[model samples]
Target: MLFVSRAIDKLNDTIATAVSWALLLAVLICAGNALIRYSLNMSSNAWLEIQWYLFAAVFMLASPHTLRRDEHVRIDVVTGRFSRRTQVWLDLLGFVFFLMPVCLVILYYGIPFGLESLRSGEMSSNSGGLIVWPAKLLVAVGFALMILQGVSEMIKRVAYLQGRLDASAFTKHAVTPEEEIAAIKNANHLT
Candidate 1:
């Protein structure tokens, strides 16, 4: 079980790194497009098409990584006040009742949609003439990753519920130094 958990953690880390780099590339592409449009007064439809494709790819690819890192937004207004054990129970219930089912649905639909796009050789509707099947395929790939990560999380949560796991065994969320610095800099009273 430990080995399996560790392997999942490694895969999650690799995916996160890849997503991070892809996001950086997306930003660069958008920035370059903006610069060209503003300075040259000439638009490349390809640039616009690439921008949207990158946006879609980044969104899909980063989803599993976000879930793995517990970065997804939640109300947490009530969950924050619960005791640790109670929170564990809530998490278990929520996963079983909500998250898992949603992921399964996405996986089921996204696969066929992506496969159909590939089979039909879908291309961008833009004048840029970009092949869009690859971006479409990212949907299935991302959801599949999310499902794997969800299963891993469910395993850990079940272990916790059964008293076979410690709270520390689960991944914890914390603000990084960069985020801390950004927060400080963005505070209105800081200046």
Candidate 2:
């Protein structure tokens, strides 16, 4: 289970690192396009559309990384009061019962959506824009990654509950400024 979790984490980490560069490239494209349009009186619909595509790609592809890093938003006001073990159980239940089902549904719908786009060779309505199937495919791929990450998280949570893992083994969300400061101090101490 730990091996599976680590592999999933590493995969997401690698993908996230790569997608981050795409984000930077997207920003550069946007800036360059704007400059060309304003300063040189030139721009292409394709360029504009590519900006949106890259934005969507960054958001969709980085989701697993966000989940693995514990950066996804949560309603912590209530959960913060629970014991850590209780929180683990809640996370497990949420992943197994809620997150997993949603991902499956998205994947179910996404495949046909992407296939239809591919079959039609769908292009953006924008002049000279890229094909639509690739973006549609990201929906399925993103959800699949999300589902896999959820399973990895579930395995870790269960292992923790079973006393096979320690509290420090899991990603910890900082609930307060003090916690964040303490974390920085601990990190510094480690070095």
Candidate 3:
């Protein structure tokens, strides 16, 4: 189980990095397009359409890693005050009641929608001209990755709750060198 979780984490990290770079590229492309249109008096319909597609890809590909890293926005007003055990229970409840159901629904519908688009050879209506099927397929792929990561998280949490796993064994947080340096600097400043 540890090996599996580690492998999943590695995969998620790779995908997240790729997605981040893709988003950066998208921003550069959009900036360049704007500059060309304003400064050069040239417009590109293709650039505009491609920007949207890249944005979609960036979000879709990064979602699973965001969940794995607990980076998603949450109210946390209440959960932040809870004990570790209570927080685990809250996470379990939210996962079973909310996250799982939503992912299942997306997986159910997204597959057929993407398949139909592929079958019909769907293309974007944008003046730039783009294939729609690949973007549509990202819906299913993203949800599937989310589901897998959720399962890994659930297993680790349940193991911790059952006393079969040490808290440190399942805990994901670790201080990086940069954070340690920052902490030391702050302490020195206080002195």
lDDT of each: 0.77, 0.89, 0.82
Model 3 steric clash pairs: none
Looking at model 1, residue 148 earns an lDDT score of: 76
For candidate 2, lDDT tens digit of each residue in 1-191? 79999899899889889999989999999999999999999989989888887888898889998988777888888998999999999999899899999999999999899889999999998787888888898898889889989988988898999899886766764678998899899999999
Best by TM-score: 2
Clashing residue pairs for model 1: none
Candidate number of the best lDDT: 2
- lDDT score for residue 78 of model 3: 84
Q: How close is candidate 1 to the true structure, as a TM-score?
A: 0.84
Q: All candidates' TM-scores?
A: 0.84, 0.90, 0.84
lDDT of 3 by residue, 1-191 (tens): 76677678778779889889878889999999999999999987778877887888888888888878776777578887988888888887877888889999999999999999999999888676788898899899888888887777777778879887766644457578999999999999999
Runs with alpha carbons beyond 4 Å of true place in candidate 1: 171-191
Ranking by lDDT: 2, 3, 1
